[model samples]
Target: MLTLTDSAMSKSVSISNIRLYQFIREKCKIAVVEKNQATDDPSIFTQPKEKWVTMIVNNSFLLNLFIEDIDFKETCREEQEKLEKEKKRLDNNSVKKRPKCQQNYITSKTNHDNCHYHGAFVYDMNNHCKLTREQAQTMTQNVKLIASNSASGRSMELPKLIWDCCLGLYGIDPPCQVGSCGLPNEMKGQAIKPGQDLMTLVQNLFMNNQAAEKRTKDFS
Candidate 1:
């Protein structure tokens, strides 16, 4: 009977090393190193260095799956440190160069123009039209119905019409009270672009509504 030598049979392999090799073989591709004139030896009988020794990790997701939790956490900690350093550097650089409006939104002093004007107009209109709470709710439902129905084709002209109907005011030139209530012109020309037409304004209103709906859904 032939017997194996202790040098060959008694050698031990680490579990971590075995797992790493298995992971690389299962989740990554192995490639042979490209032959270069300086390193390539045609007369050498041995296999190329990269043929059995190199791993090419093309699938990042699979590679991540095989990584140890401890290693992954360490990498994330390092990355977060780097990001914090970068943010500190940027904040210092921007302290003197930041625009006036850059930090205004975070400040306590809000413009409040939209809130004040829009609220005032709505309150006055409720008083002028003698709209009860139930009536206001009904008008809200009607507006939502029109918005839902007008989501396709050339239905951009429906918001103003729905508003007009809800307020019981409709015509080529509506009543002065209806006009003063801020329907169709909420800002009273405060922020209107010089060349913007009615169609553009209506389109913008719908876009704002769509954005608001998306935010609501996201939060929900």
Candidate 2:
């Protein structure tokens, strides 16, 4: 399961930050689903492959946003530096009037402590995806529901997709460009197929749903 470190949690109190974190978690779940699907069924490789690429691109974009917003890299650097300093201090401690065997044991303990801190840092870096395999399967079902609706021309707008799943929480619109507040026009009106790209698929589904709604009201 993905988890925010205490520092990350403390910094993510704002609505936007919380949403960003949630978005990352969801993408991780989706990636897991895509990976499993591709592995299980080679016939649909092209579709899942495209979706996986989209997931990676979008996730990377969002993660960069999160890192910048939360100053995550700086925080990690500071933490690592502190650990290094503590290790150095322990290493430089004077061994006063101790037996040679006792001194060896103390030195070994200090090394063990340093190794433990390093291992923890590595674990924190690696273990961010929070979903179990069962949970990922459930998430796959949800994605398929949306895809099936889209395929049947009964496209339903997902509330979360309205903001491209994350940016709306920051009071921004979809297709935002990096290092700028202005929204990009690259994806505007771009036609996409169901299961091609998750974000675009959802956005297209939303648009189709809106058009259908308007037509219904007009006919009525």
Candidate 1 lands at a TM-score of 0.15
> lDDT per residue, candidate 1, 50-162, as tens digits?
34433355545444544543232223445689999888767544422102111222212333232111111111133333232234446666766786787573333322221
What TM-score does structure 2 among the candidates reach?
0.14
Per-model TM-score, in order, reads: 0.15, 0.14
- Candidate 2: residue 127 lDDT (0-100): 29
- Model 2 misplacement above 4 A: 1-25, 31-63, 66-220
Poorest stretch of ten by lDDT in candidate 2? 116-125
Give the total clashing residue pairs for model 2. Answer: 4
Which whole-number lDDT from 0 to 100 does residue 55 have in model 2? Answer: 29
Task: Please write out the lDDT profile of model 2 over residues 1-220, one tens digit for every residue.
Answer: 2333358447332234666667665554442222224356657545323233132433445556544643322234456899998988786563421111112223333432221000000001122322322343465467668878675766553322112112122112422222211112434476646656433333343334444344333433
Estimate the overall C-alpha local distance difference test score of candidate 2.
0.36
